[model samples]
Target: MEKLKEVHVSRDEKEAMLSEAMGQWWLGAIGTMMKTMGPEATMKAYGPTMRQIGRDRASRFIKEKGYKGHDVMATASVIRIWEKMMGIEGQFLEASTGRVVFRNTKCPLSGTVPQARPSLEYAM
Candidate 1:
């Protein structure tokens, strides 16, 4: 009983906090410019967004053509591009003080790369 009480925190909680901190750092440093990667920012952020947009459209493949979105889903670099703003896609503005909260990564049961599972996107 004492051993259990002695425990300070769970590993999951620590990892979550760490991940959030990293995300905040990204935002503080370049998230603003990345979201506004428009005439107000650089072309680097643009590439990721464009890729995400294309990927989103590709998602339609499941319904339109029965294609899965697995490998593409797990790609941290790719998902992070759209994860900005909590995957709130389709707009220049988001809930984060006019700036988008970029993810650059996916979470368990959150966003998955194109997979064979039909539950992913209404499956084909």
Candidate 2:
């Protein structure tokens, strides 16, 4: 096996890299599954598994981050961070007092949706 070289990146760069890697992994998994198992099988097998993974990730994030309280603003902030890290281009709006709304105009996952994988598209 070849030894890996160490590389350095800033915190923001690291977050962006991780986000891109995750997006690639998600889409790649779906494509691979769809190719090997057909769309139906991919939907049936991969969809639920993906949903579970997301749920588990969120749970772990909450636990590890030690986030407290049920503040909607806090939740929105967390979501915004995640979205930024995921390379999602969007805007957050202050619709009213104590109301924060996020509108995603561009998503890394959207471009891949037209390739005929409903499971992947919907999951995105």
Candidate 3:
């Protein structure tokens, strides 16, 4: 009989795995919903819920980061943090008091579920 070696995963690796799994699950679920319910109906049903989730996450992020102001820079900083967390490859074209522009080159959710794109774009 052969003995198996123990394997360990680092926290960062675990987080990445979890993030990828969640993204895949969301894409699959949304794709299914869009197919069954139609885009408009699916959006109508889930749009407000998604907005609330975003607001809640933003609030928690601000609190956790101890962000003082809701200024453009602060918002941009939070966005940058989110991009990194989500494994999104992107560049900030401009981040100013008046504007914050970002171009995403790669997304964690991209190319995973093509049918979900149209519905997910609205949520995004």
Best by lDDT: 3
Worst 10 residues of 3 by lDDT: 115-124
Estimate TM-scores for all models.
Answer: 0.30, 0.56, 0.75
Judge candidate 3 at residue 56 and give its lDDT: 93
Tens digits of lDDT, candidate 3, 41-97: 888988898888878998887688777778888777876776676677878899799
Ranking by TM-score: 3, 2, 1
Give candidate 1 misplaced runs (Cα > 4 Å). Answer: 1-7, 31-41, 45-124
lDDT of each: 0.43, 0.70, 0.77
**Highest-TM-score candidate:** 3
- Candidate 2 per-residue lDDT over residues 21-106, each given as its tens digit: 87677678777777788887777776787678766866787899987645777667666666676577877666444788777787
lDDT of prediction 2:
0.70
Off by over 4 Å in 3: 1-16, 115-124
**C-alpha lDDT of residue 86 in model 2:** 57
Better of 1 and 3 by lDDT: 3
Off by over 4 Å in 2: 1-22, 35-40, 69-77, 93-101, 113-124
